[model samples]
Target: MNTHLLMIEDDHRLAQMVAEYLGHNGLQVAHQADGTSGLAQLQSPDTGSLPDLVILDLMLPDMDGLEVCRRIRALPGPAAQVPVLMLTAKGDPMDRIIGLELGADDYLPKPFEPRELLARIRAILRRRGDGGTPAAGQSLRFGSLEIDRDARTVTVGGQVADLTSYQFDLLVTLAERAGRVLTRDQIMEAVRGRELEAFDRSIDVHMGRIRAAIEADPKSPKRILTVRGVGYVFAKQQE
Candidate 1:
Protein backbone atom coordinates (compact mmCIF):
# COMPACT_ATOMS: atom_id res chain seq x y z
CA MET A 1 0.00 0.00 0.00
CA ASN A 2 1.21 3.49 -0.79
CA THR A 3 1.99 5.45 2.36
CA HIS A 4 -0.80 7.83 3.26
CA LEU A 5 -0.14 11.40 4.41
CA LEU A 6 -2.43 14.19 5.55
CA MET A 7 -0.93 17.63 5.06
CA ILE A 8 -2.40 20.57 6.98
CA GLU A 9 -1.00 23.59 5.23
CA ASP A 10 -2.42 27.08 4.74
CA ASP A 11 -0.48 28.03 1.66
CA HIS A 12 -2.61 26.95 -1.25
CA ARG A 13 0.21 26.93 -3.78
CA LEU A 14 2.58 25.10 -1.54
CA ALA A 15 -0.07 22.57 -0.61
CA GLN A 16 -0.92 21.87 -4.23
CA MET A 17 2.73 21.59 -5.16
CA VAL A 18 3.39 19.16 -2.35
CA ALA A 19 0.31 17.08 -2.97
CA GLU A 20 1.11 16.71 -6.63
CA TYR A 21 4.74 15.89 -6.00
CA LEU A 22 4.03 13.31 -3.31
CA GLY A 23 1.22 11.73 -5.31
CA HIS A 24 3.56 11.08 -8.20
CA ASN A 25 6.06 9.45 -5.83
CA GLY A 26 3.95 6.48 -4.75
CA LEU A 27 2.24 8.27 -1.85
CA GLN A 28 -1.37 9.17 -1.15
CA VAL A 29 -1.66 12.82 -0.12
CA ALA A 30 -4.69 14.40 1.49
CA HIS A 31 -4.74 18.14 1.88
CA GLN A 32 -6.43 20.45 4.38
CA ALA A 33 -5.94 24.19 4.09
CA ASP A 34 -6.44 25.09 7.73
CA GLY A 35 -5.98 23.54 11.13
CA THR A 36 -9.69 23.20 11.79
CA SER A 37 -10.32 21.36 8.56
CA GLY A 38 -7.21 19.26 8.96
CA LEU A 39 -8.20 18.27 12.47
CA ALA A 40 -11.71 17.47 11.38
CA GLN A 41 -10.33 15.24 8.66
CA LEU A 42 -8.29 13.40 11.20
CA GLN A 43 -11.24 13.12 13.57
CA SER A 44 -13.47 11.76 10.85
CA PRO A 45 -11.57 10.02 8.13
CA ASP A 46 -13.70 10.02 4.99
CA THR A 47 -12.12 6.74 3.96
CA GLY A 48 -12.78 5.22 7.39
CA SER A 49 -9.06 4.79 7.99
CA LEU A 50 -6.57 7.10 9.59
CA PRO A 51 -3.68 8.35 7.48
CA ASP A 52 -0.36 6.74 8.23
CA LEU A 53 1.27 10.08 9.00
CA VAL A 54 0.38 13.74 9.47
CA ILE A 55 2.33 16.62 7.93
CA LEU A 56 1.47 19.59 10.11
CA ASP A 57 2.30 23.21 9.43
CA LEU A 58 3.57 25.26 12.34
CA MET A 59 1.47 28.20 11.30
CA LEU A 60 -2.15 27.54 10.54
CA PRO A 61 -5.11 29.75 9.76
CA ASP A 62 -7.22 28.84 12.78
CA MET A 63 -4.73 27.46 15.35
CA ASP A 64 -1.04 27.23 16.04
CA GLY A 65 0.57 24.15 14.60
CA LEU A 66 1.70 23.23 18.05
CA GLU A 67 -1.86 23.43 19.28
CA VAL A 68 -2.94 21.22 16.41
CA CYS A 69 -0.17 18.83 17.37
CA ARG A 70 -1.32 18.89 20.99
CA ARG A 71 -4.83 18.08 19.86
CA ILE A 72 -3.65 15.24 17.61
CA ARG A 73 -1.74 13.66 20.47
CA ALA A 74 -4.78 14.07 22.66
CA LEU A 75 -6.86 12.09 20.20
CA PRO A 76 -7.93 8.66 21.37
CA GLY A 77 -6.96 5.26 19.92
CA PRO A 78 -4.49 4.65 17.14
CA ALA A 79 -5.04 8.15 15.78
CA ALA A 80 -3.22 9.56 18.78
CA GLN A 81 -0.23 7.38 17.98
CA VAL A 82 0.07 8.43 14.35
CA PRO A 83 3.50 9.88 13.66
CA VAL A 84 3.63 13.65 13.03
CA LEU A 85 6.23 15.46 10.97
CA MET A 86 5.90 19.17 11.75
CA LEU A 87 6.81 21.90 9.26
CA THR A 88 8.17 25.13 10.69
CA ALA A 89 8.75 28.52 9.12
CA LYS A 90 10.67 29.84 12.07
CA GLY A 91 14.37 29.64 12.76
CA ASP A 92 13.91 29.38 16.52
CA PRO A 93 15.16 26.05 17.87
CA MET A 94 12.63 26.17 20.66
CA ASP A 95 9.76 25.58 18.23
CA ARG A 96 11.24 22.24 17.29
CA ILE A 97 11.88 21.45 20.94
CA ILE A 98 8.33 22.22 22.00
CA GLY A 99 6.88 20.17 19.15
CA LEU A 100 8.96 17.13 20.12
CA GLU A 101 7.97 17.50 23.76
CA LEU A 102 4.36 17.63 22.63
CA GLY A 103 4.71 14.28 20.79
CA ALA A 104 5.84 15.36 17.34
CA ASP A 105 7.97 12.66 15.74
CA ASP A 106 10.03 14.97 13.52
CA TYR A 107 10.24 18.54 12.20
CA LEU A 108 11.33 20.14 8.93
CA PRO A 109 12.03 23.80 8.54
CA LYS A 110 10.33 25.70 5.71
CA PRO A 111 12.09 26.48 2.39
CA PHE A 112 12.95 22.79 2.33
CA GLU A 113 13.50 20.75 -0.75
CA PRO A 114 10.69 18.47 -1.83
CA ARG A 115 13.23 15.68 -1.98
CA GLU A 116 14.28 16.32 1.62
CA LEU A 117 10.66 16.43 2.69
CA LEU A 118 9.99 13.13 0.98
CA ALA A 119 13.16 11.72 2.49
CA ARG A 120 12.06 12.82 5.94
CA ILE A 121 8.61 11.37 5.50
CA ARG A 122 10.12 8.06 4.48
CA ALA A 123 12.59 8.13 7.37
CA ILE A 124 9.93 8.84 9.97
CA LEU A 125 7.86 5.90 8.79
CA ARG A 126 10.86 3.55 8.62
CA ARG A 127 12.15 4.63 12.03
CA ARG A 128 8.79 3.92 13.57
CA GLY A 129 9.11 0.23 12.76
CA ASP A 130 11.45 -2.44 14.17
CA GLY A 131 14.32 -0.83 12.19
CA GLY A 132 16.77 -3.74 12.22
CA THR A 133 16.69 -4.25 16.01
CA PRO A 134 13.75 -6.68 16.33
CA ALA A 135 11.96 -8.67 13.70
CA ALA A 136 8.24 -8.50 13.20
CA GLY A 137 6.29 -10.52 15.81
CA GLN A 138 9.34 -10.47 18.10
CA SER A 139 8.68 -9.49 21.68
CA LEU A 140 11.15 -8.26 24.31
CA ARG A 141 10.33 -8.90 27.94
CA PHE A 142 11.65 -7.30 31.10
CA GLY A 143 9.64 -8.21 34.13
CA SER A 144 6.26 -6.56 33.64
CA LEU A 145 7.38 -4.57 30.62
CA GLU A 146 6.91 -5.89 27.11
CA ILE A 147 7.97 -4.44 23.75
CA ASP A 148 6.12 -6.00 20.88
CA ARG A 149 7.65 -5.11 17.51
CA ASP A 150 4.92 -6.57 15.37
CA ALA A 151 2.24 -4.59 17.11
CA ARG A 152 4.58 -1.68 17.65
CA THR A 153 3.44 -1.46 21.20
CA VAL A 154 4.89 -1.26 24.69
CA THR A 155 3.05 -2.52 27.70
CA VAL A 156 3.81 -2.71 31.41
CA GLY A 157 1.96 -5.36 33.36
CA GLY A 158 -0.55 -5.74 30.55
CA GLN A 159 -1.58 -2.10 30.71
CA VAL A 160 -1.01 -0.37 27.40
CA ALA A 161 1.80 2.17 27.41
CA ASP A 162 1.08 5.34 25.45
CA LEU A 163 3.96 6.12 23.11
CA THR A 164 4.36 7.98 19.85
CA SER A 165 5.56 5.73 17.03
CA TYR A 166 9.01 7.31 17.05
CA GLN A 167 9.30 6.84 20.78
CA PHE A 168 8.35 3.21 20.41
CA ASP A 169 11.17 2.67 17.94
CA LEU A 170 13.61 4.48 20.20
CA LEU A 171 12.70 2.17 23.03
CA VAL A 172 13.24 -0.79 20.74
CA THR A 173 16.73 0.44 19.86
CA LEU A 174 17.71 0.53 23.52
CA ALA A 175 15.95 -2.68 24.53
CA GLU A 176 17.56 -4.69 21.76
CA ARG A 177 20.96 -3.64 23.07
CA ALA A 178 20.26 -3.96 26.74
CA GLY A 179 23.09 -3.32 29.23
CA ARG A 180 25.20 -1.42 26.70
CA VAL A 181 25.57 2.33 27.03
CA LEU A 182 24.89 4.25 23.82
CA THR A 183 25.91 7.80 23.15
CA ARG A 184 23.35 10.19 21.72
CA ASP A 185 24.88 9.93 18.26
CA GLN A 186 24.89 6.14 18.37
CA ILE A 187 21.26 6.01 19.44
CA MET A 188 20.22 8.40 16.67
CA GLU A 189 22.22 6.46 14.11
CA ALA A 190 20.88 3.12 15.29
CA VAL A 191 17.30 4.30 15.12
CA ARG A 192 17.91 5.32 11.45
CA GLY A 193 16.48 8.70 11.97
CA ARG A 194 16.86 11.49 9.51
CA GLU A 195 19.40 11.95 12.45
CA LEU A 196 18.93 14.44 15.26
CA GLU A 197 20.58 17.85 14.95
CA ALA A 198 24.11 18.31 16.24
CA PHE A 199 24.12 18.10 20.06
CA ASP A 200 20.33 18.19 19.98
CA ARG A 201 18.98 17.32 23.43
CA SER A 202 15.72 16.11 21.87
CA ILE A 203 16.87 12.58 22.57
CA ASP A 204 16.72 13.45 26.25
CA VAL A 205 13.20 14.74 25.75
CA HIS A 206 12.15 11.49 24.10
CA MET A 207 13.79 9.44 26.84
CA GLY A 208 11.94 11.38 29.53
CA ARG A 209 8.65 10.72 27.77
CA ILE A 210 9.41 7.02 27.30
CA ARG A 211 10.33 6.69 30.96
CA ALA A 212 7.04 8.19 31.98
CA ALA A 213 5.16 5.67 29.90
CA ILE A 214 6.73 2.36 31.03
CA GLU A 215 8.60 3.05 34.25
CA ALA A 216 6.68 2.69 37.47
CA ASP A 217 8.24 5.94 38.54
CA PRO A 218 9.46 8.14 35.74
CA LYS A 219 11.39 10.33 38.19
CA SER A 220 13.63 7.38 39.01
CA PRO A 221 13.65 5.37 35.84
CA LYS A 222 14.93 1.84 36.36
CA ARG A 223 14.45 0.45 32.89
CA ILE A 224 16.42 3.18 31.17
CA LEU A 225 19.25 4.73 33.13
CA THR A 226 21.22 7.83 32.22
CA VAL A 227 24.99 7.39 32.17
CA ARG A 228 26.00 10.84 33.46
CA GLY A 229 28.15 12.39 30.71
CA VAL A 230 27.98 9.35 28.44
CA GLY A 231 24.48 8.60 27.17
CA TYR A 232 21.98 5.93 28.28
CA VAL A 233 21.58 2.19 28.61
CA PHE A 234 18.54 -0.03 28.78
CA ALA A 235 18.69 -2.26 31.82
CA LYS A 236 19.11 -5.93 31.08
CA GLN A 237 17.57 -7.01 34.32
CA GLN A 238 14.21 -5.64 35.40
CA GLU A 239 11.92 -6.46 38.27
Candidate 2:
Protein backbone atom coordinates (compact mmCIF):
# COMPACT_ATOMS: atom_id res chain seq x y z
CA MET A 1 0.00 0.00 0.00
CA ASN A 2 1.16 3.49 -0.81
CA THR A 3 1.89 5.89 2.04
CA HIS A 4 -0.72 8.62 2.50
CA LEU A 5 0.49 12.21 2.81
CA LEU A 6 -1.37 15.46 3.49
CA MET A 7 0.13 18.70 2.23
CA ILE A 8 -1.23 21.88 3.80
CA GLU A 9 0.18 24.47 1.51
CA ASP A 10 -1.37 27.70 0.25
CA ASP A 11 0.80 27.98 -2.85
CA HIS A 12 -1.18 26.25 -5.53
CA ARG A 13 1.63 25.78 -8.01
CA LEU A 14 4.02 24.40 -5.42
CA ALA A 15 1.37 22.13 -3.98
CA GLN A 16 0.50 20.73 -7.39
CA MET A 17 4.13 20.13 -8.23
CA VAL A 18 4.88 18.47 -4.93
CA ALA A 19 1.76 16.35 -5.03
CA GLU A 20 2.55 15.14 -8.52
CA TYR A 21 6.15 14.46 -7.67
CA LEU A 22 5.36 12.53 -4.49
CA GLY A 23 2.55 10.71 -6.27
CA HIS A 24 4.99 9.39 -8.82
CA ASN A 25 7.09 8.13 -5.92
CA GLY A 26 4.31 5.86 -4.58
CA LEU A 27 2.77 8.31 -2.10
CA GLN A 28 -0.90 9.26 -2.09
CA VAL A 29 -0.79 13.04 -1.77
CA ALA A 30 -3.76 15.06 -0.57
CA HIS A 31 -3.68 18.84 -0.60
CA GLN A 32 -5.57 21.62 1.17
CA ALA A 33 -4.91 25.27 0.38
CA ASP A 34 -5.64 26.68 3.80
CA GLY A 35 -5.09 25.74 7.40
CA THR A 36 -8.80 25.79 8.15
CA SER A 37 -9.65 23.31 5.45
CA GLY A 38 -6.64 21.21 6.26
CA LEU A 39 -7.61 20.90 9.91
CA ALA A 40 -11.17 20.08 8.91
CA GLN A 41 -9.96 17.41 6.53
CA LEU A 42 -7.95 15.81 9.27
CA GLN A 43 -10.94 15.72 11.59
CA SER A 44 -13.53 14.72 9.02
CA PRO A 45 -15.24 11.43 9.67
CA ASP A 46 -15.59 10.40 6.02
CA THR A 47 -11.95 11.14 5.16
CA GLY A 48 -11.62 7.33 4.86
CA SER A 49 -8.36 7.15 6.73
CA LEU A 50 -5.87 9.44 8.35
CA PRO A 51 -2.67 10.30 6.51
CA ASP A 52 0.60 8.71 7.57
CA LEU A 53 2.38 12.07 7.37
CA VAL A 54 1.75 15.81 6.90
CA ILE A 55 3.81 18.31 4.90
CA LEU A 56 2.87 21.72 6.25
CA ASP A 57 3.81 25.15 4.97
CA LEU A 58 4.52 27.75 7.65
CA MET A 59 2.71 30.55 5.91
CA LEU A 60 -1.05 30.12 5.61
CA PRO A 61 -3.96 32.45 4.93
CA ASP A 62 -6.04 31.34 7.89
CA MET A 63 -3.50 30.58 10.60
CA ASP A 64 0.19 30.10 11.20
CA GLY A 65 1.57 26.65 10.42
CA LEU A 66 2.96 26.36 13.94
CA GLU A 67 -0.54 26.90 15.29
CA VAL A 68 -1.86 24.29 12.88
CA CYS A 69 0.75 21.84 14.09
CA ARG A 70 -0.18 22.53 17.70
CA ARG A 71 -3.85 21.94 16.94
CA ILE A 72 -2.98 18.71 15.20
CA ARG A 73 -1.04 17.51 18.22
CA ALA A 74 -4.06 18.39 20.36
CA LEU A 75 -6.39 16.26 18.28
CA PRO A 76 -7.82 13.04 19.64
CA GLY A 77 -6.01 9.69 19.69
CA PRO A 78 -3.92 8.82 16.66
CA ALA A 79 -4.64 12.07 14.91
CA ALA A 80 -2.63 13.95 17.50
CA GLN A 81 0.36 11.72 16.89
CA VAL A 82 0.50 12.09 13.12
CA PRO A 83 4.01 13.03 11.96
CA VAL A 84 4.49 16.55 10.57
CA LEU A 85 7.24 17.88 8.34
CA MET A 86 7.27 21.66 8.27
CA LEU A 87 8.05 23.76 5.17
CA THR A 88 9.28 27.28 5.67
CA ALA A 89 10.40 29.97 3.33
CA LYS A 90 11.74 31.99 6.23
CA GLY A 91 15.43 31.72 7.09
CA ASP A 92 14.83 32.20 10.80
CA PRO A 93 16.23 29.52 13.07
CA MET A 94 13.56 30.17 15.65
CA ASP A 95 10.82 29.15 13.26
CA ARG A 96 12.36 25.73 12.72
CA ILE A 97 13.00 25.31 16.43
CA ILE A 98 9.44 26.27 17.26
CA GLY A 99 8.09 23.82 14.72
CA LEU A 100 10.11 20.98 16.16
CA GLU A 101 9.15 22.00 19.69
CA LEU A 102 5.53 21.74 18.63
CA GLY A 103 6.08 18.12 17.59
CA ALA A 104 6.94 18.49 13.93
CA ASP A 105 8.93 15.44 12.88
CA ASP A 106 11.15 17.43 10.49
CA TYR A 107 11.52 20.63 8.51
CA LEU A 108 12.82 21.75 5.13
CA PRO A 109 13.67 25.25 4.05
CA LYS A 110 12.35 26.69 0.82
CA PRO A 111 14.16 26.12 -2.49
CA PHE A 112 14.96 22.59 -1.47
CA GLU A 113 15.28 19.89 -4.06
CA PRO A 114 12.40 17.48 -4.60
CA ARG A 115 14.72 14.58 -3.93
CA GLU A 116 15.71 15.95 -0.51
CA LEU A 117 12.07 16.28 0.37
CA LEU A 118 11.51 12.69 -0.67
CA ALA A 119 14.47 11.56 1.40
CA ARG A 120 13.15 13.39 4.46
CA ILE A 121 9.67 11.98 3.97
CA ARG A 122 11.03 8.47 3.70
CA ALA A 123 13.20 8.97 6.75
CA ILE A 124 10.32 10.19 8.88
CA LEU A 125 8.09 7.37 7.69
CA ARG A 126 10.84 4.86 8.33
CA ARG A 127 11.13 6.02 11.91
CA ARG A 128 7.36 5.79 12.24
CA GLY A 129 7.44 2.04 11.43
CA ASP A 130 6.76 2.18 7.70
CA GLY A 131 10.07 0.60 6.81
CA GLY A 132 9.51 -2.73 8.57
CA THR A 133 8.26 -4.36 11.70
CA PRO A 134 10.47 -3.92 14.73
CA ALA A 135 12.13 -6.99 16.15
CA ALA A 136 10.16 -8.75 18.87
CA GLY A 137 11.41 -8.61 22.46
CA GLN A 138 13.52 -5.64 21.53
CA SER A 139 13.52 -3.85 24.82
CA LEU A 140 16.41 -1.92 26.37
CA ARG A 141 16.94 -1.17 30.00
CA PHE A 142 19.36 1.36 31.43
CA GLY A 143 18.66 1.30 35.14
CA SER A 144 15.53 3.43 35.57
CA LEU A 145 15.15 4.10 31.88
CA GLU A 146 13.31 1.52 29.79
CA ILE A 147 12.62 1.43 26.10
CA ASP A 148 10.25 -1.01 24.43
CA ARG A 149 10.86 -1.01 20.68
CA ASP A 150 7.86 -3.18 19.83
CA ALA A 151 5.49 -1.03 21.87
CA ARG A 152 7.25 2.23 20.88
CA THR A 153 7.17 3.47 24.44
CA VAL A 154 9.73 4.76 26.88
CA THR A 155 9.68 5.09 30.62
CA VAL A 156 12.08 6.82 32.99
CA GLY A 157 12.10 6.10 36.68
CA GLY A 158 8.83 4.16 36.38
CA GLN A 159 7.20 7.13 34.68
CA VAL A 160 6.11 7.27 31.07
CA ALA A 161 8.03 9.86 29.08
CA ASP A 162 6.06 12.06 26.74
CA LEU A 163 8.19 12.28 23.61
CA THR A 164 7.47 13.17 20.06
CA SER A 165 8.00 10.35 17.56
CA TYR A 166 11.29 11.78 16.35
CA GLN A 167 12.69 12.20 19.83
CA PHE A 168 11.81 8.65 20.71
CA ASP A 169 13.67 7.33 17.71
CA LEU A 170 16.67 9.52 18.52
CA LEU A 171 16.78 8.06 22.00
CA VAL A 172 16.64 4.56 20.62
CA THR A 173 19.45 5.26 18.21
CA LEU A 174 21.64 6.45 21.03
CA ALA A 175 20.65 3.67 23.40
CA GLU A 176 21.29 0.96 20.85
CA ARG A 177 24.82 2.23 20.50
CA ALA A 178 25.42 3.08 24.10
CA GLY A 179 28.96 4.07 25.19
CA ARG A 180 29.91 5.14 21.67
CA VAL A 181 30.22 8.78 20.76
CA LEU A 182 28.03 9.49 17.74
CA THR A 183 28.71 12.73 15.92
CA ARG A 184 25.79 14.91 14.92
CA ASP A 185 26.25 13.84 11.32
CA GLN A 186 26.14 10.17 12.25
CA ILE A 187 23.15 10.66 14.51
CA MET A 188 21.18 12.57 11.91
CA GLU A 189 22.09 10.02 9.25
CA ALA A 190 20.99 7.18 11.50
CA VAL A 191 17.75 8.81 12.59
CA ARG A 192 16.74 10.85 9.54
CA GLY A 193 18.61 9.05 6.77
CA ARG A 194 20.24 12.33 5.83
CA GLU A 195 23.44 14.25 6.40
CA LEU A 196 23.62 17.20 8.76
CA GLU A 197 24.10 20.65 7.31
CA ALA A 198 26.57 23.13 8.74
CA PHE A 199 25.16 25.26 11.60
CA ASP A 200 22.07 23.09 11.75
CA ARG A 201 20.90 22.87 15.36
CA SER A 202 17.83 20.70 14.94
CA ILE A 203 19.56 17.70 16.47
CA ASP A 204 20.61 19.71 19.49
CA VAL A 205 17.10 20.97 20.02
CA HIS A 206 15.65 17.46 19.73
CA MET A 207 18.27 16.15 22.11
CA GLY A 208 17.27 18.76 24.69
CA ARG A 209 13.65 17.75 24.35
CA ILE A 210 14.49 14.08 24.76
CA ARG A 211 16.58 14.77 27.83
CA ALA A 212 13.81 16.74 29.42
CA ALA A 213 11.58 13.70 29.12
CA ILE A 214 13.99 11.02 30.36
CA GLU A 215 16.55 12.72 32.53
CA ALA A 216 16.08 13.36 36.21
CA ASP A 217 17.69 16.72 35.66
CA PRO A 218 17.76 17.92 32.10
CA LYS A 219 20.21 20.70 33.10
CA SER A 220 22.75 18.00 33.77
CA PRO A 221 21.68 14.99 31.76
CA LYS A 222 23.02 11.60 32.76
CA ARG A 223 21.52 9.34 30.12
CA ILE A 224 22.77 11.34 27.13
CA LEU A 225 26.09 13.07 27.57
CA THR A 226 27.45 15.68 25.16
CA VAL A 227 31.10 15.67 24.21
CA ARG A 228 32.67 19.04 23.70
CA GLY A 229 33.34 19.82 20.03
CA VAL A 230 32.20 16.32 19.18
CA GLY A 231 28.62 14.96 19.48
CA TYR A 232 26.65 12.96 22.06
CA VAL A 233 26.98 9.62 23.77
CA PHE A 234 24.53 7.48 25.68
CA ALA A 235 25.96 6.40 28.99
CA LYS A 236 26.78 2.71 29.05
CA GLN A 237 25.87 2.51 32.70
CA GLN A 238 23.03 4.51 34.13
CA GLU A 239 21.89 4.95 37.69
Error of 1 at 117 (Å): 0.8
Leading candidate by lDDT: 2
Report how far residue 6 has shifted in candidate 1, in Å. Answer: 0.7
Worst 10 residues of 2 by lDDT: 40-49
Tens digits of lDDT, candidate 1, 28-55: 8889988898888888744456888899
What pairs collide in candidate 2?
Answer: none
List ranges where model 1 is wrong by over 4 Å: 45-47, 129-136, 193-195
lDDT (CA) for every model shown? 0.87, 0.90
C-alpha RMSD for every candidate:
2.1, 1.8
